[model samples]
Target chain A: MNRFAGPDGNIETEIQKSLLNIDGGIMNILSTVIRKTILTVSFVSLLPVITLTVSAQELNALVWCDHADDKLLKPFEEMHNVKVNIKTYEGTGAALSIIEQSAPGDWDVLVVDAPDAPTVAGLGLLEPYDASTLPMSDLFPQLTEAPFNYLDGKRYTIPEKFGYYGVAYNKDKVDPEDMKTAEVMWNPKYKGRVAVYDYYFPTMQLVAISMGISPDNITADDLEEIRKRLLEMKPNIKMVGDIVSVQNALVNGDVDIILNAAEFVVSGLMPTLPSLDWNIFEEGGLMWIQGLSIFKDSKNKDLALEFVKYVVSPEGQSRLATSECYWAMPANSTTQLSDAEREILRWDEQPGYLARSVPSTISRPEIDAKMLDIWTEFLQK
Target chain B: MAKESKSLKPLHIDYTRWAFHPALWFTICFFIFPLAVMLAISFWQRVYGRLSATWDVANYVKFFGSDYLIDSLTNSIEVTVLTTVISILLAYPLAYILAFKVPKRIQGILLLVAVMPFWTAYVVRSYSWLLVISENGILNVFLKGIGLIDQPLEMAYGQGATVLGFVHFFTMLITLTIYANLVQIKSSYWKAAADLGAGPVRIFFRVTLPLSVPGIVVGAFISFVIAIGDYITPQILGGGTDILIPQAIMLQISRAANFPMASVMAVTLMAVVVLVYAISAKHMKMERV
Candidate 1:
């Protein structure tokens, strides 16, 4: 009767058995699908919470390009079991803009030009930290009492890295003797062969130093003279640009000399490009120091302070000194840099260089504006 | 049938009216609001690096008074106009071939090949150009190999290089726009001109060229607007030999946090673009093709 019958010859029984089997198979498939859908939906629903938990452990920093190095930050992240989010800005103005646009507690740390640190502190954006807590003894003595690191007799930021705004040149193309004097900036022989680093402050300061005017002593009246001196070098200046552009000019042989640049511009390239070298002029070098500070409204203040501590440590200093972005002298005197690395940074010459250099300062607002105006004229010339 | 049509008219009108709401909202939220804010900010002042709502036009006064600053505006206009003229000159012939000469079956592929470089990053393309034209770059190396010159040419950096960079990018953009306009022209128009005892050259000059004015004007306007506002191309290739308005604007914002002054420059730039639009409005057939 029924071909689907098992062993018994009952047609109704065989038919019922076959129907049950079909229903069971459909139920199994439905259960599996429902289970998978439920699991997936549950997982997706918890994603935001999971993300919140992970982000809560992150430390946000607004810094210069140097602090973005993975080699400098990875150890700190691994040690603290936290994520570090960095936003690199070109200038103090940009960093301030970022802070102004963000909500309170959004940023945990800041790295600023040392001369601007006090101004930033005056704005009530930074929290004061004890000098005793920092590794002050291990740092160069001159960096410890930096006037810009303090405001109203309280320390607001600590110097993390320091370098000079001087000269970098291709030794093969230029006479090494000519680089020792600031006169090389305006030397007619090198006309259209010099690239000036396009930073108004230190470059103007260098011009002031060449004119035998100290940067700290610069007044509003001195800008015209400084502007004149700056324009005198226009003949020699093939280009004026930022670190990367000036570096490109040098590497491409577009220019033979770079003004307002030192080891920070060419030190990293020296090992591969032995022809490149940097030195300060006899007039004196203008020192540029970058400072680290904690934000006043940081939710993760403790973690932020710990990161500062890690950055100023010897190991961190070494990594930072050889950072991918640029190589410069670390604030900490006792960095663990290799012998070859030390040679590139001119470690042994730091004492003499530091003695000759006065830290670059932020001028009064009027003077700063005047400097920018004159610098613009120099560029447009 | 008339009753049914009348009944559907109100529904159709209602649907069309509601459809524009999203675009209106977007314009208000993104364009009108920010522009209003910028206009307001232009009258403010930066007092010791802090934004002050003094509601004065001193920033504008200062910009107009400074010769160096005014030079930046002039430089921008000069560079942008030169670049736009050069780009249109280069793009038109390429677009004409694509629209009239290339076979319809492979036009799409050919157009893709023509604009393929547009897919790359702008900054990368700029730097690549620098590497090719720099003193010791590829061009010099090749010239040296061929013993064409004893010294490397001073080709990179300056207004010429800046124009070159802009032309390289905008040429492709303009070609696409011109091609679009060219293809939409009825073939019957060209055929009609030929049938009227006109030669190919005469027909092209009288009919095809005249019809392509809308595309050229539209492209030129876009090129003018973008080139004038751009900071990177001029900054990278111009080599600080001169300063453009955008670079001058950036200097204020980046170095001084002088948003009031930056806003002044931006408003001035916007005014120039609007003036250009007014000048070219007759031929800008934006809705066509």
Candidate 2:
């Protein structure tokens, strides 16, 4: 006998009897309604399990690694009776891919590159959030750039953190004076003793900046020179890597200097490795801004907006700046910091650093593809 | 009698035939369906932010046309071939030792020892290798202290590091497979060879190796497929110096959010794996195991 043979397993008992009672033509309609009702009931029964899986108070965010730190999120999570579920990605590219794969309303918050805010918003990916309650007065003057936090005169993404992409070096091995110029990047003296940041946009822009082209005004004509300059430095570069890899290169003494690193590389390590430091070259550095935005399709719009507001708040800003991923300067000017953290960020030198840096330029698709091609060639060199 | 048999068939269905249903459905749903989707998407194009359903081979053209992109596949094959060959060379001896030299009473424990490192995570194993070989790592510290060199050697980055990481993992896998093949050989075959006046070396070359081709080929083919499709080892240790096909595929998805381009590269990778399987199928009698 079949294992399922039993009174309950026999479909003919109830369903067949019901079908026999209906006329042939009417049977189809009756069966359709019955199926719909049963499906509705089954779906309703699964509601609580689904709710438990992602509770009402839970906020799902796709963001950078810094926001994943429990220390950065704990207070906010506790006070709001909510859980902040974060998926950290290294770049806006990776983050976008993650968001694309997710179901509608699956994500509540998005932390992305400040320059990408306008582009992402135009894609209808961001919710236009009111920033009236936010401590806008306490934001760093430079971080309030319209192109970054505002799109078409409306708020989309709010800058949460900002840092320079420049030279980070071990003072014991590198001459600090020589580090002041971009020329040190390709210097033979540092051959096989340098690691570079692996991102194409900022690295290419930094190269353009060195060659007297403002990042915002880089033209196709400028790329030939830029590519040549990048290739020349290949022999000197021991490795090109992301944040953690470049930091590992420096901390492990595998490289003496990171050609495109900034405070994120040395800020946390400054105390343990006091010799590690960073500086913007005379040619200027690329300013990278990270911002927070609410997803357009977020189910929890109110909660997500509040979370974004809190991230830009003074208390949240401090914790975020010192998050375990890496340390950088928080956008909120009122962030409380100890003497050591302040020293590492060089809090007093903000004006000087901002003066010598240009925020990242919004990339056009054609130009972006061209630059990526060049960068790929440089890596293979 | 035949009409009665037809009635009996309905009451006593061939349940044994239904056993293969699960595997068939699994293949259709997971493997065949996804592969079809990937293949279909490969001909689609993604222009800027827009994904067009209009079929075209621009992606495949660009993939093959770009030297930079083509180099990654070349590099992948080079690395995978070297890793598989090196793995077999190292694993065969260890497998031989375990199968022949180790006492039967303790062979299980010895085999367990061979698998001890596999218990650790694969990514962790690669990370450990990086830590051990970095310029300031123990290898350098010890070498310097022993007066081997005045300056620390660079051993932790580039293609070399990637190969070392792959070889470390694949060797263990190949060893287990080869050892299983070795022990299954009949003892009478070796006895007959010795009686025929064939020396130990001759007997090993003539009798043992010939019997073990299936295991070796199976292991090597597995190693090749896995090492070629892998993204992590090259990403973490290769230092972005050499791009592998998997990395290039991810670059499209991540950097450009270009799904069509990524799909093309993935399909290409699958084609290469299929070609490899076709070539090795003759010596790959996995059913014998």
Worst 10 residues of 2 chain A by lDDT: A1-10
Score chain A of model 1 by TM-score against the reference chain A.
0.86
What tens digits encode model 2's per-residue C-alpha lDDT throughout B1-289?
Answer: 9998887874567777876799988999999999999889889887666788879898889889999888888999999999999999999999999899989999999888878887988778877888888988989999999999898888988889999999988998899889989999889988999999999999999999989988899899989999999988998888878788888887777677678888988988998999999999999774443
Binned by DockQ into CAPRI classes (incorrect, acceptable, medium, high), candidate 1 is medium
Q: Any residue pairs clashing in model 2, and if so which?
A: none
Candidate 1, residues B1-289: lDDT per residue as tens digits? 9998988885435767766799888999899999999999999988875788999889899999999999999999999999999999999999999998989999999889878878988788888889999999999999998999899998887889999999999998899989989999988887788889899889889988888899999889998999999988888988986889999988887777788889999999999999999999998874433
What does candidate 1's lDDT look like per residue over A1-381, in tens digits? Answer: 568766778877776666658958655676799999999999999986786586559899998888888888899988987889999998787788889999989999999988888889999999999767777889887987888888999999889999999999999999999999998888898989999888898898898899999888999888889888888888888888888899999999999999999999999899999999999988897888998999999999989989998988999899988888889999998888888988889898999999998998876787877788888888886
lDDT of 1 at A242: 84
Q: How does each model score on lDDT?
A: 0.89, 0.85
List of chain A TM-scores, every candidate: 0.86, 0.81
i-RMS for every candidate: 1.1, 1.3
Query: In model 2, which regions exceed 4 Å deviation?
Result: A1-63, A68-110, A123-134, A294-315, B1-20, B286-289
Model 2 chain B, poorest ten-residue lDDT window?
B280-289
Q: Estimate TM-scores for all models.
A: 0.85, 0.83
Q: Please tell me how candidate 2 rates in CAPRI terms.
A: acceptable
